[model samples]
Target: MALPTNHSLLLPALLKGSKTSINPSFTISPKSPLTISETFSRLKKQRKVGFIPYITAGDPDLCTTEKALRLLSSCGADLIEVGLPYPDPILDGPVIQASTIRALTNGVNFQAIISMLGKVVPELSCPIILFSYYNQIMKINQESFMSALNYGGIQGLIVPDLPFEDIGSLKKRANKKNIDLVLLAAPTTSNYRLKAIVDASDGFLYLVSTTGVTGARSNLNSQVQFRLEELKKETSKPIAVGFGISKPEHVKQLSIWGANGVIVGSAIVKLLGESKSSEEGLRLVETFTKSLTSALP
Candidate 1:
């Protein structure tokens, strides 16, 4: 199958030092915020915990990924994480690693992934947050890289391996393009370091549930509640919990614990990769996503 490529996917000639977003499709003012921040802010007003689903782009195939994105938007995902496939391990667990391998094997490259996003993002009801590693963008001109993503309708970015000290500059560049450079904080993060992450993180902070890689587990650690409470006390920014959360009950538990958003990744990736057919996979995604949202209040 030929992957969808949008010719309009040119590297956008975006203006620099401008707080406005670079998407030609929309006129954004300098003070206008990225969609992810806005979404979280809205959810905060409604006193609801947002449901964010993660999927490896071009996994199994780009077509399936596109269909999945569309379905997820309509099914109740407040925001979607479109993971850019990388060959090396950057803390991805078994399920996501396998999905990444499948995507790479299918010849899924950055251009193809951006093309698909450019074509489908306008149709999505929710914002897209591209999850990637630092090296992927390090190879290119940082401004141009951010410009490409902004043109494709990516509202946020998550580079898991980027160091805390190096984050300031990157965050500034992404901010100029109207992209939220979300940072991650783990269970082991020191209070001082945690405070820095909170201040630098653009839209929201990704709070890792466990110390290990991203995957589904039988139970969420009891300490996660305490962690959420501690982090919430620190900032008004949204905190989305990821890793080890696989079921609706878990989501219910997190919502009760005062989480602003919950990210279900490996469970959903595992479902899509193990399904016998694309239709079956999407059916499962729809049901599971709805159930997850139902748990959010």
Candidate 2:
């Protein structure tokens, strides 16, 4: 499919220029957060394992999403992945798929997320990584999308289903904007593929601990320890393990095996999914995030 160059068509609500528009209070002024590379390097020197939590934007509501983001940052999150609500999510399991559906049903989109982030990013201490699929990225186009990232203080982007062979152009564009195109490395990836991923992925290589789609599990894939060790041998860049990470014990185990960070998603998304009110959602996020962070070295 051809990407639409006209970004105005990307989000009518955002470009409408009303009080409900994206720039109601925050202008499209560039306010970039720290780069993902710098954040990982800083953590490496500090000898701290980064904790990145994933949440769906506008899940309970967009307003609640903002509060939850701030709460996560304050709760010791090194980075936050805000899943841009898409009609189709390539890698999401039921928990995240349900959360994404909730947000989309409430009118969350690429532009809405950018609008929400514009006001929320300035207050956040850590970098924000936007998790989006390929078509959604194309819908916003490249340059305008990068501009929106700056406007929203987002520092990283993850296209979960993007082909490794096709990442050249997008990765080049992201590099120009200092936005890390974080790539995933699964347990089944061969060393040749892993080597390519090491060279291509910025910030850190996202090691999917399981072979299947993302969801919380009682225990992690036992092969993750060996995979972490193998990745450490091949690349100097940080390695952050994600997928099936739900428990503090999982976080501790990853850290002990030399992981630079851990990304927890379905578990946190589930917490906010059950919330009856914004307050309850934020409270659940805070308590659970603190538990995960405390387990990290």
Candidate 3:
């Protein structure tokens, strides 16, 4: 599919201080305030595809989570998705569910995650997108949650459980704080609603590869390519496919299918948990991120 002249898929913001991100004419903020669209537009200009990896904060401990986050950015992740351990993760698979359990058991809550990001965000090269459930935000109220994200210098958010039709006030609050409220689209979404989601979403639109929860799969659903093509016709927003994407080949295929980015979650979570130590886990994450990113066009 030929991309719209004004709608090419873009890259995440280049790391601050890196030659790629430096511009002599303008002053760059200490904290990267790059919106999701700006980052994707950069990616598009560079002809690079996005690699987003998800990890549960405070999986084993906050200290480890901090290290892992730094490793993800330095490695190859364009945007990192940091999952807040919620009591109920209906959209997550067993691997991600186990990660949430470990995080919750280790006493990681919303406040604790915020504290961890406060220290880690300053050191990160790429933007952080917090993955949260709608209920968690409701308990504290949307405005409070947005305030916490802004305070931590978070650039984006992915609320898997929030419906696009009902995201009015929540999205408004996020916009006020300059936080991108990324909306998700499923293969099952109807055409009219898909357009609504595309119009409402900031940063980029998440396209779920399957109808089920997040996990690594041996084979992608055969219809995913068709869905990607279908969505591209509705809107020019960057489309990122998530859920069940595990291998480099999957990333390559999605790129061919017109995905601006590919989000890998359960695979990274499983890898982190399987590692013997936090240091090793960090190494594994960095290595895995590099491998997947290298596959991007």
Give lDDT tens digits, candidate 2, residues 220-292: 8888988888888877989999999999999999999999999999999988877887788788888888888
User: Which whole-number lDDT from 0 to 100 does residue 255 have in model 1?
Assistant: 92
Using all chains and alpha carbons, the TM-scores for the candidates as numbered come to 0.90, 0.90, 0.88
Expressed as tens digits, the lDDT of each residue in 1-297 for candidate 1 is: 222244442433332223443444442212213388889889988899999999999878999999999999889888999999999856899899999999999998777787678778878878899998987776555766787687677888999988888887788888988898999998789999999998888888899999989899999888889888998887888898999899999999999988889999999998887799988999998888888888789
Q: Would you list the clashing residue pairs of candidate 2?
A: none
Q: Write the per-residue lDDT of candidate 3 for residues 144-249, one digit (tens) a residue.
A: 6776677566998999887777899989988987889999988999888888888999989989999989999998887889988887776778998999999989
The lDDT per prediction is: 0.83, 0.82, 0.80
Off by over 4 Å in 2: 1-33
**Number of the top-ranking candidate, with lDDT as the measure:** 1
Tell me the deviation in Å of residue 83 in model 1: 0.3
- Collision pairs in model 3: 10-40, 10-43, 10-44, 11-39, 11-42, 11-43, 11-44
What are the RMSDs of all candidates, in order? 5.2, 5.8, 10.5
Cα deviation at 124, candidate 2, in Å, is 0.6
